[model samples]
Target chain A: MPEDFEVNPWDVKGKVDYDKLIERFGTQRITRDLKERFESVVGELHPMLRREVFFSHRDLDLILNDYVSGKGFFLYTGRGPSKEMHIGHLIPFIFTKWLQDKFRVNLYIEVTDDEKFMQKNELDLEETRKWAYSNIQDIAAVGFDPDRTFIFTDIEYVRNMYPLAVRVAKKLTFSEVRATFGFTESTNVGMLFYPSLQIVPTMFERRRCLIPAGIDQDPYWRLQRDIAESLGFYKVAAIHSKFMPPLTGTEGKMSASQPETAIYLTDDPKTVRLKVNRYAFSGGQPTVELHRKLGGNPEIDVPFQWLYYFFEPNDQVITAIERDYRSGKLLTGELKEILIEKINEFLERHRERKEASKDMIEVYMRRGKLATVMWETVHGLSV
Target chain B: MPEDFEVNPWDVKGKVDYDKLIERFGTQRITRDLKERFESVVGELHPMLRREVFFSHRDLDLILNDYVSGKGFFLYTGRGPSKEMHIGHLIPFIFTKWLQDKFRVNLYIEVTDDEKFMQKNELDLEETRKWAYSNIQDIAAVGFDPDRTFIFTDIEYVRNMYPLAVRVAKKLTFSEVRATFGFTESTNVGMLFYPSLQIVPTMFERRRCLIPAGIDQDPYWRLQRDIAESLGFYKVAAIHSKFMPPLTGTEGKMSASQPETAIYLTDDPKTVRLKVNRYAFSGGQPTVELHRKLGGNPEIDVPFQWLYYFFEPNDQVITAIERDYRSGKLLTGELKEILIEKINEFLERHRERKEASKDMIEVYMRRGKLATVMWETVHGLSV
Candidate 1:
C-alpha cells in the first residue's frame, strides 16, 4: 500500500516517500548518470547531491547543457519571512551556495516579506519586516559570493519587479491560480496576486533559472513554466529536495510552532545539547544491556537521519557510524552526543559569521556587482 | 417609475436620472445651501456648480468645515488610459482644476496604465502607456497648478504607492471587491488588486481627501471609506458629477469605440462641425416649417445639453439660448452651428495649451514642488 502522506507549498504531513513523490509530481529522479554529469562539470559533487538529498528535478538537464555550452544559467531561491530561522530553513540556502560557488553564476534570493504578512492574519507588515532582516543575516552566513548574489525583499524591491509581474499576472486568470494554489473565495486579494511577485525573479536573467528549493514549492515552478516562454523568457528549471525531518521523529518535517521538535539557528550550545539528549528519537533497545545485544536501527533514527542529511558530510565517517550502530557497537546516548556536537559547531560558526557580516548584507542586497545592476534595471518584457 | 439605467466604474448605460442616482448610490444632493456656502468662501460658484451639473456629494460639508477651520483637504482623481480621451474624459479634470485654483490645495492624478491593460484583453502595457502620455497632455492642458499638482502613472510610480496599497489590500478580501466592483472568478488578479492602488491617493495626506469624479466612481471611494480609519487616515470626501451625454443621443455616456458619438480633443474644426451637424441628436420638429410652428424641446436636445453642461459658462448667454430654443427661435441647424463654434474654439485653445505646456507636464509628473516631494516619499501605515 502507498504510504499515508500529503505535501503542498503550504503544508506537509506524515512520512513522505521521496521516490513516490517524484512519480506523483511528474518529475524525474536524479539518476546516477545525471550525478556523474554534474560531477564531470564541477569536478566534484556536493554532499547533498552525492547522497541524493536533492533527488527530483525538472528541466535540470537542459540547464546543465546550457552551462556546458557556455549559454549559461542562473539560480533563484526565496524565503518567506514569517518567523525565526531554524536549521531546516537553512538547508536549501546551504546547498544553493554550493551550486553558486561551483558554477560561478549569479543567484537571486527573494525574501517574501509581503507574502508572509498577507498570508498570516496575526502577522503585520512591521513584524514580517523585522523577521526579513534577521533571516537575511542567516542566509548571508551561508557564505555566498557577495559579488555574484543579490538578495531582495518583496516590499522593498517591488517597484523593479511589478511591471514584469503584472505582465505575468495577465497571462494567468484567478481560476488558474485558484486551482494551482488552492486559493478560495475568501483569500485576500494581496495573497492571491502574490504568486506573480514570486515568479518575477526567475526571469531576471535571459538564461535559464535553476531553483534549489523543497519539493513542496514545485507547483509555483509548474505555473511559471506554463507562461515564461510566452513572456519572452525560458521555462524555469528546478531541483527539488526532501524536507529535513523533525528532531523528535521522522514522520514529518520540522514545525516552527513546536520548539522542542526542531533546533533553531539561535539555539545556544546548552539548549542544543539538552534538546538532543532529551528529545532525539532513538532506535536502540530499552536498556544498555539490551542495546548491546540487539543493536540499533539507524534507518528509523532521527539523530542519524539529521546527520546523514546535512551535519555529517564525510562519506567514510557516516558509513562507519551506520555500521557501528547496526552492529550493536554504538549506544543511543553516544549517537545523540555526536549529533549534539555537530549541531553546536555548525551553529557557532553560523552565529560568528552572522555577527561579522553586518556590512556584507548591504553588499548582497544593494552594492554588490550583480545587485547594483539589478537595482539600476527594471525587469519587463524585452519586446 | 424608476429609470432603466446601470452605473458602475466599468460600464454606464441608459439615461441616468440625477435625482434617482443620488438616492440609488446613497449619496446626498448638492443642496442650494452648499452652493451659497461655496459663494461665501470663494466669492462665486463655478458654472458647473452654479448650474448644478455637479449635483451630488458625500461629505462636502465636512471638507468645507475642515477648510474653513484652518485645517485643509486635498483633491484626488484618476483616469484609465485604455484609449484616446475625449471631451467627456476631461470633465472631472476641468472641475478639479477649478477646485485647486480656488482652494490652493495639492492634487494627485493617478494615470492607471496597469489597470487598463489588465481589464482589457486586447490592450497591452505598451499600448496603454502610449495612451497615458497622450492623456496626461490633455489633463495638463486643463491648466492645473503645476507647483501643487502631481501626476503619476501606475506602472512608473507603483514603487512609492505599493506599500500603502498592500496595507489597504490586506484590509479587503476577494469577496468584498467582487461585490463592490462586480468582479468574477474569471477576473485577472491584477484587476482584482487595482482598487487598492486607486484608493492610496485618498490617504496621501492626513487631512480629508476630496474627489471630483463621475458618480460611477463612488463605489471605489465607498470601499476606501470603510478601511481608511483603520489604517490611520480619514475617510475620503467626494463631489460627484453627471456624465456628458454622447453626441448621438442622451441615453448613455460617450464611448471611446464610437468615435462619432464623442468629440476627440484632437478633432479639428472640420471633423467637429461634420460630426455635430450630421449626428447631433435634435429635439426639434422633423422639418423647418414644423419646427417654426412647434417649439423645440431644449431639455432633450444634445446640443443644448452640451451648452448647459460646459460650453456656455455665462449665465445670461445660457439663459438666452435656453429661452430662444424653447420658443422655436433657434432652429436645429442654427443650434448645431452654435455648439460647433463653441467646441472648435475650445479645441483650438486646448491644442495650443497642450503644445506649450510640455515643460509644465514635467513639473506635474516629476520636478515641481509637490511632484518632487511625492517622489521622495513612500506612503504607508502612519503608525
Candidate 2:
C-alpha cells in the first residue's frame, strides 16, 4: 500500500489537493481556453482568468443560456468566519468579483459570524464580528465593486429578517439538521439552526446566485440547492475550486494556524525563500545521479504546485524547469530560486496595487453593503 | 343521613341556602349594614349591592384591613369568550363596578381571546375579537370610570403586556405542558403555550390585578400562581365565587351548550318565565302530600339558591320565603313565580342599561388602555 494512504483527514494542513482528488475520483481536468464560452454563459471574465484555478462550475452554462435569452442572476458566496482569513479566502471572492464585474450580476456575500461563534466557543461574538469585518476587507481587496455587491453580517440581518428566517427554520426539522451536520443529541438549538442561516441567503429571491466553494463543501451546497427547490427558492449554482495547498506540505492546503504553512501575502522575499527551502515538502533521490533517474514528482512537490498556481508569466519557464528537473538537469535548489523569484514578483505587483489599500477597501465594503442591504430588505430580509 | 345529604349539585331551580355555603367554607355573609366593611375588603360594595346578588365574600376582614391601612390593590377578572355574552356575563362587572365606586381602586378586565382560541379551534380569531369588544361594552355598561379601569384582550395583551409569557414558554417542555393541560403530541404549539398566556395577564404588573372567578377554576389559578414565582412574576391574588349550578334541572352551573342552563340578559320576559317554570330544578316532592310531609328540601332546590346569588333586594322578603318554604307553606310553583318576577326585574334593569349603551364605552376602554400601555411598553412590545 502507498504511504500516502495513511494520512488522516483532519491532520492534513488546511484542505486537500485537486489532482490527487481528480485521480481518486477518476475525473479529467478542464484544460483549454473556456473564457469565451464562459462569457457567453455568464457575460464577462475578470483579469485573474490568465490562470484558471476556478476551473469547474455547475449550471454556469445554463445560466448563461438563460442570460442570452435576456435573463439575469445574482451572485452569492459565503465567508464563514470560523478562523482568521488567509489569501485562500480570496478564491471565491476572486471569482465572484470577476463574475460581478463581467456580468453586472448583483452580489450577496454572507458573513456567517453566528455560525463561527457556535462552531468555536473561545471566540466571543464581538471578536468574531471583527474577524468577519477583516475577512470582508480581504474579499473587498480582491476588487468586488461596491455598488453591486452586498455583505451581510448574519446577526444584524437575523434580527430584522425574523419572519423569513422563521419560515425557513420551521420547514427544517431538528433531526434533519442533526443528520446533515453529524450533530449529537447534546447539540444546542443554535447549532441546529445554523445551516438554515446559509440556506436563507440562497432563497432570497426566485433568481440566480452562484456559490463558489472548495470541493469538500460540495456535499453541503448540494443539499442546500436541493432544499431550495423544495422550499420554492431559485437553485444556487456551485463553482468548485481546487484546494490551495500549504507551504509545509502538499499533503493538503495552507491553514492560518501555522504561519510557516502559508506563504502569506505579507511575506518578504527572504521569508518566502527560507519558507520554501526549509519547509516546502519535496522528494528527491539520495544522490544527484540517482535523482536524475527518479526525476521530480511535480504532483507531490508543494513549491512546484504553488509555482503553477501563482507563476503566471512563465508557463514555458515552469515547463522547461519540469523537463530539466525530470531529466535531472535543474536541481532542487535551482527550482526553489525560480519559485522565490516568481512569488517576489507576485507580491511586488500586489504591493503596487495596494495603493490606498485600507481606505479603498473600507470604502468598497461600505458601498457594497448598501446595494446588498437594499436588495436584502426587499427580499424579505433586512441588513 | 339527613335528606339534605343527597343534594343534587347540578340542580339549581328549587333553592339553596347559601348560609350553609358560608358556614361550610368559613366565609362571612356580609349584611347590607356592613356596607363600609364590605367596601373596605372587596372594595366598595357596588349599587348592584344595593340590590344584593353578590351577598357574601371571603377574607373580607383581611382585605378590608389592607385597604383601610392606605394599602391599595387592584380589581381583576377575565372572560373566556367561548360564546356570546349573556346577562350572566354581567356578574363580574356589577361586582367590579361596585368595588371601583367604593374603594376607588384600579380595575383590570382581561378578555381572554388567546385562551379561548387555544382551547377551541372552531372559534374564529376575528369573531372572538368582536366578542371581546361586545363583552367589554357589557362590562362598561355596568358603569366603570374611564381612568380607573384597564381591559386587555389576551391575544393582544399576551403579545404586549408581558415578556413573562416568553420566559414561561422557554421554561416549559412539551411534556410539562402535556401533563398540565392533558395535551398530546398532536396539540398545537399555540395551545401548548396557553397556560403561560393566562398566567402572564394575571400577574401583568406586580399583582396589579386580582382575579375573580368561580371556585372550580381555582385549580388553574393556583397552578398559575405556582408557576409565576419561577418566572419571577409577582404572586397574584384570586377571589373565587361559589359555583352557581346551571338551570338544566338546576343541577349545575349554567353551561352555554344547554339552552335551559342559563339566563340570557337578552331573554324576553316570556322566555324567562317559561325557563323559570319548566327547567329550574324542583325540590318539592312529586305530590303535594309528599311536599307537605317532607317540607321543601331547601338544599337541592335550585331557585332558592339562585335567590341567594341574585335576589338581594330585601332579605326580610328572602328570609320570609325561606321560612315559608321549609315550613311547607310555599309551593314549588309559588317559589318559581317569585324567582321569575325577580329575574325579570333584574333583566329589565340590565336591558335598560344595555339600551342606553353608546360609543362612550370605547372611550373608557381606550382610556383604561392608555393608563397602562406606557408601563407595559417597557419591553418595547406594545402596539
Candidate 3:
C-alpha cells in the first residue's frame, strides 16, 4: 500500500494522519494520563493540549518530573526566515510563550537566517536578514516574557555558539545527517552543518530542554537525542504540534509560495474578508435548498478547522458554531464571516502590539535578564 | 606503473618528485623569468626563492603586476593546531614573514583550532585551543610587522568569518568538497564546512590576496579560485613551497607522530644532538677506512639536505660543505655534528624570541593596527 501523506522539516504533502505520524516518528502520543498530569501541574490546560492539537512527545514525561522535583527545564524553538511569515508560523511561538509565562523558565528563539540563505539558491543573506527582522517583530508581538526570552539570529550569535556547535558537529558524520535529514550529495555544506547550530541551544542550560514545535521539526531533536547524553547533556524533550491546515483545503500545510493558500500577518481586514470569502474551503452543498436539507460537515471545513486550531479559543463558542454549522442553521457565508472577523481582530491586536513593542525587541534580544546571562556566557559541554 | 609518492593536505609519503607534482596539481613552476621579476621588484630574492625551495606558483606574475601598479596584495597562511610547533611547520611562516617584511603588506594568520579538533577523533576543542596558543606564540616569534599582522584562531574568530563562510559554503555542495578534500561519508560535518572558513580570509581584502604555503594546500585555493571572481573578488595568488624532508630520510615530510623524525621548536640542545646522531640518515660508507675512499652522496644525505633547505643560508659556506662532503673529506658524523650545532643555534634564538615576545601575541591578535580593524569588520563579499 502507498502512503498518501509525507511530512518533513522542509516539506509537507496531503492530509496527514497525526496518529500515523506519531508511530512513524517513534514518538509517544499525548494520552489522557499525560494531559491530566499537565493539567494538575499547570492548573489548566491550553486549548491546543485540550483538543489534542499538540498531540505527540519525546521525553516530555521526564521534563515534567524534573520540574516537579525542583530541577527546571528551558524552552527552545526557532524560525527559518526566508519569507514573510503566515498565520501558520505563529503556532509554535504562541505555545512557547505560554509555556514560558506559566513555568517562568528561560526561552530561546533562534532565527536561522544563515540556514535559510544557504538552503535556497536565490535567497541572499541580506534578504534573509531583512525577513529575520520582520519575522522577529511579529514573534515579539506575541508577548513572550521579555526578561525570560532571548531571541537571536544564527549569523549574529555564531561567535558564542560555535564552540558548542563544532562539538556537536564532530559527533555527527555526513552519513548520520544524510540518513536523518534526507540530505544528498547536492546538499550545500552549510545546510549539512546547520543541525549542530540548532542543537546548541538545547545544551545551553544544564537542565532539560523542552521544545514546542511542529512535528516536522522532530527529526532535529531525534539527532540531538542520539548525541546529547554522550556530550554530557540531557536529551532534549519535545512537544510536537500538528500542522495548521491551509485555506484552500485541509491537505498540506500553508506555504509562503502560494499566497492564496495562506494569509499573511500583514493582510488588512478587507483582504482577510476577501480571502476568507473567496478562498476558504467550505463543506456546504451547492445550493441553498440542498445545504438546508443536507446540512454541512464541520470535519473537513477549513474555516471551522482554523477556528478550532487557533483563531476562536473559546470552547463554548467553537462548540456552538460547530453544532449550528452541522445542523444547517449556520451557512458557509456566515461561518466565513465569523472566521474573517476573528482573524482581522487577531491581526489588529498583533499589529498594535508589534508597533508598541518596538523598544522591547532589544529587551527580548539582548537586554533582558536571560538574554544578558546568555550573552555573557559561551555555552558548551563541561569537560 | 605505481607512483612511489603521495601528497595531500593531511598526508605525504615516499619520495616526491616536485616537477611531477607541478604537472599533477596543474600549477606553474617558478621560472627564471618570474624569479628575475621578483628580484627586480623587491631589490633582492629570499634564499628559498633563489634555491627553488619555494618552487611552484599559481599567480605570482599577477601579484607582481598588482604591486607595481599600486594595486597591492596581502598575504594569508594558516596552521592547524593539533601538536607542538616543529621546524617543518615553520617553513612557510618564516618565508611569509620575509615576504611581509619586503612587501610591507598585511598578513592574516589563521590558527585552525576548529579543524584540528574536528579532524582528530581523540582531540578536543580545549586541547586544540591550548596547542593554538602555543603554536601562535611560535608564529609570533617570527616577528611579523605588529601593525600589519593579524593572527587569529578559528574557534575564537568564527563570528567575524561565519557570514562570509556561509556565503562561500552556499556555493559549494557536499559532492564538491568530497572531491576536493577526499571527504568520505564518515567525515564529520565540521570538516566538510571548514573549507569555507579557510576560504574566507582570501576574500578579506578587495585587492589581490597572495598565499605562501606548502603546495599540499593548493586544493583549497583551487576551490577558492573557482568561486572568487563570481563573488566579485580577485582570484587569489599563491607561491607554493616543497616540504622539508624528515630527519630519517629525504622521502616524506616530517611527522609529528614520530617524534624522532622531526625537530620540535622546544627540543633542547642535548635532545637535538641525540636525535640527530640516532635518527639522521647517512649517505657515507659504513667503515671510516672505506668512507675516506668512497665519497658521500650529498644529494641523498638528510643533514646536507636540511642545511641546503633551511639552516645553512650562506651560499659559499653551503657550497663548500656540499663539495667537501661529496669528495669524502667530510665524514657522516662530522656532517651530523655541523647540523646539530646549526640547529641548536637556531633553536636558542627562536626560544629567546618566543620568551621575549609574550606581550606581542596580543598585539598581533587584537591590539595591532590591522588586528583592530579586522576585529571590527565582519568579512563578506560586497552585495
Q: Candidate 1: which pairs clash?
A: none
CA RMSD of each candidate after superposition: 2.0, 11.1, 1.3
**Per-residue alpha-carbon lDDT of model 3 for A250-335, expressed as tens digits?**
99999998989999999999889988889999998787778788889998899999999998889999999999888888899999
* Model 2 chain A poorest ten-residue lDDT run: A5-14
CA lDDT of each prediction against the hidden true structure? 0.91, 0.61, 0.92
TM-scores, each model vs. reference: 0.97, 0.54, 0.99
**Cα error, candidate 3, residue A176 (Å):** 0.9
Q: Residues A1-383, candidate 1: write the lDDT tens digits.
A: 86599888878889898888888788889999999999998899999998888998999899999999999999999999888989999999999999998899999999998888888889888888899999999999888998899999998899999889999888877898898888888888888888899999999988999999999999889889999999889999999999998888888788777898899999999999999889888888898899899999988898999999999999999999999988889999999999999999999999999998888999999999999999998888343
- Which segments of model 1 are wrong by more than 4 Å? A1-4, A381-383, B1-3, B381-383
Ranked by DockQ, the better of candidates 2 and 3 is 3
In candidate 2, which residue ranges exceed 4 Å CA deviation? A1-36, A39-57, A263-277, A284-293, A310-318, A334-378, A381-383, B1-383
CA shift at A7, candidate 1, in angstroms?
A: 2.3
lDDT score of model 2? 0.61
**Who wins the TM-score comparison?**
3
Interface DockQ of candidate 3: 0.69
- DockQ score for candidate 1: 0.58
Fnat of candidates, each listed: 0.63, 0.00, 0.83
